[model samples]
Target: MSKRSNWAVPYLIFLVIFVALPLILIVVYAFQGQDGGFTFKNVTNFFTDGDALNTFAVSIEVAIENTLICLLLGYPAAYILANKDLNKSAVTVILFILPMWINALMRTLATAELFNVLGFSLGKGTLLFGLVYDYLPFMIYPIYNVLLKMDTSYAEAAADLGATPVQVFGKVTLPLSMPGISSGILMVFMPTVSTFAISEFLTNNKIKLFGTIIQENINSSMWNYGAALSLIMLLIIGLTTLLLGGDKENAVEGGTV
Candidate 1:
């Protein structure tokens, strides 16, 4: 084998052991009953149980809101950063990423304390603020990377053709940056849907999302049900990733040609 192939052997082994094995176990447990008999009851409970359904709805709502907020905020910030003069842009980008250097748990706790001090009660609103704060960087970086690499010639050409600044941005910049937008949405939405920590910390356990439900079930020894819930979440995230990633690939390919 080539040296490159040899270099991949360790990573392949790690993937199989750490990723594939756990997924196989989850699938197995998802279909198994408490007595270890195969059954679909666990999956059925997710839909039929009112609490489970509500939790799922709440998670979806939070995820959608967080994703939209991130996109709305990140896009303009990324655009400004991408267009700034080199030195200033570099410093600004560093400042934007600085929060990521701190531990996530610490940041969440800090947010919680800050909210408490400001008289904001622990609830969905605080939870959302934490999620947006934590995941906004995920949205910004992807869009910024795409914008930074975009060809200036396209915008120049449009402007030379007598297109106004707004027209150039609408017709050229936004379309070309769609791949990054898709990527950012996927990044923010998937984690927001599945994250338990931010909700737990910021809401002080007052809010129960789908991820919280899964965690509670697992902790309460309802392994099969928890696994089933996890499987459903996995399916939703996988489908979303497939749809958005396909769009991103198409946009990238079109831009290339």
Candidate 2:
């Protein structure tokens, strides 16, 4: 691996400076307290704080709901595109990914603005729309790619054997696309969990999310609290990645040449 070229040196240097160093610093700061020595006060305080717990709950709820919503809508679109006539699939793929080109913050704001135009006002409901709108592309693209890569023969054989189109889809296309669906969920899940910008700008401070808690703590120089919450958020996102194993098994099943 190291024989690749001169590129490895700069890439490794960048990783150390940008990723490894910062992670180490966060760990060091979180565990050290007022005496400039390591302590557990930071993590302990996080549990005792009502705001921290509340924000964590809200963030989890939002991220999970967002994942489900994306899966619900994205699955059908991805399924269609995957099993589509190749001649026209390109246009549909482009359309699904089109919204991603727009800035996420801008798209989220536009959603809130849309609600205002309809006299609906903005709040949690508007936030839900923003979450779905911002992350749907993430869900669709992975699933689409997976579906596109599937063996067309499987679905064809099912149909030839008297299976209805829906049955073929249920047993073949959808199941195979699970890999991409798993990836998309993880792709969308982590950011949605840690994203402070959307919650801050959209909900107008009416709702408290875990990301906002981190932001609030940092802004107030509550470094310890921020660190604790940051660690918890990271752990949660890591747990979500474990669910992606279902995709790997599917990939292995059909990957044989």
Candidate 3:
């Protein structure tokens, strides 16, 4: 064994203290009563409360909607960037990443302002628009990276053999980029599901997401229930990551080893 391996002793201790212990505390506190006795009232409240479930469902829907929108928009942009000519690549990347430098809240307010200028308002779409815009780069970059590595000779060869531009792109480019597309979609979806900041400020708090529920529970004096809700939210993302992680594994295996 090496001395570096011994470092894991401290790392493992830290993990047990921080991650493992807190999870145990959440589980313990989740079952703890007002008088410090063990109880299931918190979990019971979760299942019994229609508002909580409804809010959670809304949050899930927000995540899904934003993810679909990002995929719809990001794919073409990413494709363009990936297949960009030498002169335009740098400019295209800079433009794609321009929004990232601005604060999310600032961008959200800007979106609201722009919408008002057009005689439209963000209102219910506030959170949706914020998330899609904020995470757009995340969706684009991964797919762009995949595209950058693509062998265009395959596309050129296909076109040379009497394939139309649309046919070659639809048949090859899109399918080949599924790995990147899936990666970007999962990246955008995960954070959007748990996002609290944009939703709270932009949606005018009209929308309730998983993160918001956790915030309400904690900030509005629902500690145990908040913790439970947080745990549930964490579980949702964790399970999603696992499922998509399997897809990533398959993609990697298919693409490489």
Query: Residue 228 in model 3: shift from native, Å?
Result: 0.9
Residue pairs whose backbone atoms clash in candidate 1: none
Per-residue accuracy of model 2 over 1-257 as CA lDDT, tens digit each: 56777778999999999999988878887887977888988888888988788888888899999999998998777777776564364787788889988899887777767776788866788787888889988888877777777788988899999989999978877776777777788777888988877876677778767888888888999887688778878778777767566556653433322
Local distance difference test values of all predictions, in order: 0.88, 0.79, 0.79
Superposed Cα RMSD, model 1: 3.1
- Let me know the TM-score candidate 2 reaches against the reference structure: 0.89
What is the TM-score (0 to 1) of candidate 1? Answer: 0.92
**What tens-digit string does per-residue lDDT give for candidate 1 at 10-98?**
99999999999999999999999878899999999888999989989999999999999999999998888899564364888988867
Q: Which predicted model would earn the best lDDT?
A: 1
Clash count list over all predictions: 0, 0, 0
TM-score of 3: 0.83
RMSD of each: 3.1, 3.4, 3.7
User: lDDT score of model 1?
Assistant: 0.88
Tens-place lDDT digits, model 3, residues 1-257: 99989989988999999999999988887888788888888888888899989988888888898989998999888777766564365886889978878887788778766776786654566667778889998888778777878899979988998889998998888888777877787788888877887777676677777788888778988788887777777788888867777667634432331
